[model samples]
Target: MNPRNILVTGGAGFIGASFTHYWLNKFKNDRIIVLDLLTYAGNMSNLSQCYENNRFEFIWGDIGNSDLVESILVKHSIDTIVHFAAESHVDRSILSPDAFIQTNINGTFSLLNAAKKVWIDTPKENNQPVIKHRFHHVSTDEVYGSLLPNEAAFTELTPYSPNSPYSASKAASDHLVRSYLHTYGLQVTTSNCSNNYGSFHFPEKLIPLVITNVLQNKSIPIYGDGKQIRDWLYVDDHALGIELVLNKGKVGETYNIGGNNEWTNIDIVKLICSQIDLKFAENSYLREKYPQAFAALSGDSASLVRFVTDRPGHDKRYAIDASKSESELNYRPTKTFEEGIVMTLDWYLTNDDWWQSIIDGSYLETNSKYMII
Candidate 1:
């Protein structure tokens, strides 16, 4: 059944904001209530267009607050919860793991407890049948740890072998979600997606970091030998995959969503540089439209590449076997790596002001302290 009232946590962040937009556009009759803490990564500007829609509402809050989550769920009569709020960056988690543990593990526990109390316990206490509710948890493939060059892609049955503190916290949360399903019989679904890149992505991520750094003529830091491979899924396609799992997926099941597009770190950066070169060469449309932005382009942006120390517990490769999601939910990525990268680059070039705010430290004065790199 289509969700009528949905609570989307982290709706101001990159992938969450993109999914919010996608859902509102696709389901006109549906209402979205967004809950976010406005952390460094959460930018209100990302949801500026969403504010104009009457069906959308934004809440400046955290998922760890049980009272707030319960109030919002009950007040809105929310039937679905798309949990996305968390500390997602690996580097930040390396520097400080406290926030990751607090937000990823404790926060998920609070959300699960609140959902159980409101949707199941309350109804049963009132001598009524359990309310139909869905708690869809958005997760990452990193929870399965690194894959060797010859190893098969990660599937639904893959054992949990998280490496870094970040992945460990998320793994703990994933287990909590599973336990809720098995013990309480909460109607829930989970999707562990590969890396995502598209518009509204924070500047610290690899793809956006490279694009912004290249545009500003800054050094593009590559960790170790830059051979770490990741399956890159377009943000919009990932949003669609989540939507499919929410609507068509069987309860108490997990789905793996991937782009089927794998590229090494160095290769991805080189491609971005090459695309920028082609776009700014001679009298291209992008060059003509944004001359100032292209003025720094020397058609050799890749020269800025600098090898640096790799972070601790860096995963070598992560690939997903999404056949189950493909066959069951009829979900397939529409854009190949080539097409999605072009679209992503185009968006970054055209929407400089959006990311500029983050770079200039004026977007949110409070968030400035959390800015890394």
Candidate 2:
């Protein structure tokens, strides 16, 4: 069903912002209400273009707040909810698990309860049930934990074995979603996606961290041997996958979304460096424009790679088997890793001001702190 009134939590964050833009662009008639706490990672600038559209509205709030969430649901007459709000970083979760538990677990519970009250308890036009309501929970493949080199990729049926606090919290939330589906009959669908990289990604992530650090001639830190592998999905492709599941997927079903592009950590970093080198060589204007940044690319940017201690309980490898999603929903990622990385590099290179603002702490409060491991 086409969702007319939708609420997207964490719409100011990276993947959330991308999904918000994609949803607005795809469904011109639909209205989207974004609820975000605007935390350290949530940036308003990510959704700058959304302000021009009348169908878009933003609310600065937390999902853990039950009264606020319920009020927003009733006010907007929301029929669909695409939840993305969570404390997602592994390193941060390792340092402080309280936020992860609060935001990922408790916050999800609040959302589920609010959705139940609105979509199940409250009647619609003729005192009938809310027939078309859906809650699409955005989840991570990390919930499946690490896979051996010989093990098959994680599928929808993969059992949960979350490693870190972040993944554990997400696993708990996923369980809550499933319980609500079986016990309360709340219409719900879940998608556990692989690592996402592309535009508007926070610099704390692997891809953006490498790109930003390389541009600034800073050391590109690699954890352990940097051989840990991850299946990488472009952010835009992930957004599309979510939309497909929201509209075409069956209720109470889980879909695995992936780019089918897996690369080791070191390989990804070196590839980015190589791409930067080629870009600087090809574009004279780009080289002339940012001399220092360009000069940092004079030699191989890979020379800046620095081996660092790996974070505790780091997953060895994660791959996805999205055959179910492909056959059932006809979903497939369009961009290969090579193509997506180029687009990602070009975006970072061109949007210097965006990353610069982040580096300069313009968006973050003076006292704000982040676990930048």
Candidate 3:
């Protein structure tokens, strides 16, 4: 297996796509094989720009497909893997945990099993090995459960106490990844990160939802008092951190990546509103026209934010103690919350098609009952 060949699972989604794009641009010498099932959230439209690149290859497949996983690994001579495929939304996981279990739990084990066969069977380098491969698990901070308002953020030593089905599922995946390293002696590392908000993000998340809602003059919904606090990390910076960890991290260790940008849910919504007003003032003609189908698609401004019921088991605060990754891997977010928020709003405005289709398709599936929980 060649070191230059790497597999990035779920590369069509938000963070995965961003990371794939970044690597495609920066590491022209390396190749990435992206495997995504193209679930409602995974769309080829996002990666259309990278289709022509020889270093990047997109495969429509599930991580749990053992045959497909083994075939891709052997065919590509892949020696590295960045596992990013998972059902990540806390609210969605609350409604149905089955998808999370299948994708996040079973899917990861399938990959690990394939890797064990490939790595163990390969020739070893005297004391080292012929194929130097690594499995990097991308994870979330929610696995640590909620933090009290005045309590310290989640650090590496924080014990596992996941609240929602989503976090529990992720916590389970994290454990499996770690266990593979210890029990199987497979080369693995894990990173738990803060909330990532940036371009190409799904509308189910907060920042994009707020930006898109305000763009349509819809009321920005806030849960409870909207006082829940979260540490926001720009996806780009998080990508950089992950890349660094993949290349330079100690096997079996876990690193926490965050933006150091913390904000209450309400404050973020208001900030987005202010940015929207500025955008409208700068471009009055588009402002007069607004986005196409704004009235028919979403709704009026106040209707935008209808807080019917709070999501079950919502966490109060989630602040990442990202110093471990920062001090160890030289990772830090260059964009502050203000800058990242503005950039996100601008991206959404410029690339409405990317998100509009997501909302449209999501609306169509709104009637489908949740699978399991």
Candidate 4:
């Protein structure tokens, strides 16, 4: 019932920014202090609206720095930590696994260590009042690995079977969170979410990549047969799910948050292409602004579809059974995939300057300009 002083790690990134906005707008009394490393994906512009709020503060830093994390926890009297910082891309992980190991594995360990030090051990050693704190880890359904067409959707009890370096690293982090809860009595909960798509999405991901490339008449690459299925969750819905977990979920529990909407890779791309073509037809200015979107102007953005070799160890499918979260926490995704996709496309089309800055590497300049250092 009381206001919470929350620390959001990686709060400038896509989903993290959404959560930060959602919390600040909904909980006027709660103070949000963000600590992010300002990596390539962490853009200050994403949180531009958050700067005006007296309850919001941004600190540019890394989660691996325990001393800094400890200082923030103590200084701000933080009671909840939403951990979203990580090296998240699968392709980047495959090409360079070292960063994944460092950021996802060792970095999570460092964070857990700091939380335990400040929240658990400090009180015991100093005989001070115990701090009421919770650490909520944000994880991916990719940690469940590939699923068969008929296999039951991944549930909270599903054993982790990670296939990619990214998923493996996330699986390790998930274990670390669980271990901390059982072994060290650090109140912790985790949510493994399906693919998230919404505003401020980086252009490299599938949905945003397709939207950006189609607008530029660039090839929309499909891997292998492009039938890999993924359950898509709108980013705002994921934020709401986390809110439920933080407010209602039991400690040491893991929740699966999903949209219950699944689409194949190729189908998702084709859908985007068709939507872009329709948008161009309905709105004449789209074609004028994106003159290079010749395919869309001709009502055939599908012309740009190109099948490419699949990445190594690519998962075949991922689905989530969020029944536990639904029944227990009363969590449900409000947006259907169709509505979410339309909104996503509209966001990208309307906010060219946002993704364009990322594509052209100008976002880094924006970060440096606004970064708190």
Top TM-score model: 4
Report the poorest 10 consecutive residues by lDDT, candidate 3. 364-373
Candidate 2: count of backbone clashes, pairs at least 3 residues apart or interchain: 0
Spell out the clash pairs found in candidate 1.
none
Local error of candidate 4 at residue 205 (angstroms): 0.3
TM-score each candidate: 0.95, 0.95, 0.91, 0.99
Please give, for residues 1-373, the per-residue lDDT of candidate 1 as tens digits.
4548999998889999999999999999999999998888998888889979999988888899899999999999999999999899999999999999999999999999999999999999999989889999999999999999879999999999999999999999999999999999888899999999999999999999998987877889999999999999999999999989988999999999999988999999999988888878854676655555442356788888999999889999999999999999999999999999999998998898888899996789644433331
Clash pairs, candidate 4, are none
- Relative to the true structure, candidate 1 reaches a TM of 0.95
Q: What is the lDDT, from 0 to 100, of the residue 101 in candidate 4?
A: 96
- Predicted candidate 4: what Cα RMSD to the true structure? 0.9
Candidate 4 lowest-lDDT run of ten? 364-373
Candidate 3, residues 1-373, lDDT tens digits: the string is 1237889998878999999998888887899999888776776766778978988888878889888888888899988899999988877887788999999999999999888777765455334564678889999999999999889989999999999988988899999999988997889999999999888898978888887776655656788888889999989998898888987789999999988878998777767766666666667664665754253233333335555456788899999988888788888788888888888888888888777778778522421222111
The CA root-mean-square deviation of candidate 2, after full C-alpha superposition on the true structure, stands at 3.5
| Residue 108 displacement in candidate 3 (angstroms) | 0.7
Task: For candidate 4, write residues 1-373 as lDDT tens digits.
Answer: 8999999998999999999999999999999999999888999989999999999999988899899999999999999999999989999999999989999999999999999999999999999966899999999999988999989999988888999999999999999999998899999999999999999988999999999999888999999999999999999999999999999999999999999999999999999988998999999889789998889999999999999999999999999999999999999999999999999999999999999999899889878866555
What would the per-residue lDDT of candidate 2 be over residues 105-187, giving only the tens digit for each residue?
A: 99999999999887887665458956568999999999999999879999999999999999999999999999999998999
Candidate 3: list runs displaced more than 4 Å. Answer: 1-3, 122-130, 289-306, 362-373
Q: How close is candidate 4 to the true structure, as a TM-score?
A: 0.99
CA displacement after TM-score superposition, residue 183 of candidate 2 (Å): 1.0
The whole-model lDDT of each prediction reads 0.91, 0.90, 0.82, 0.94
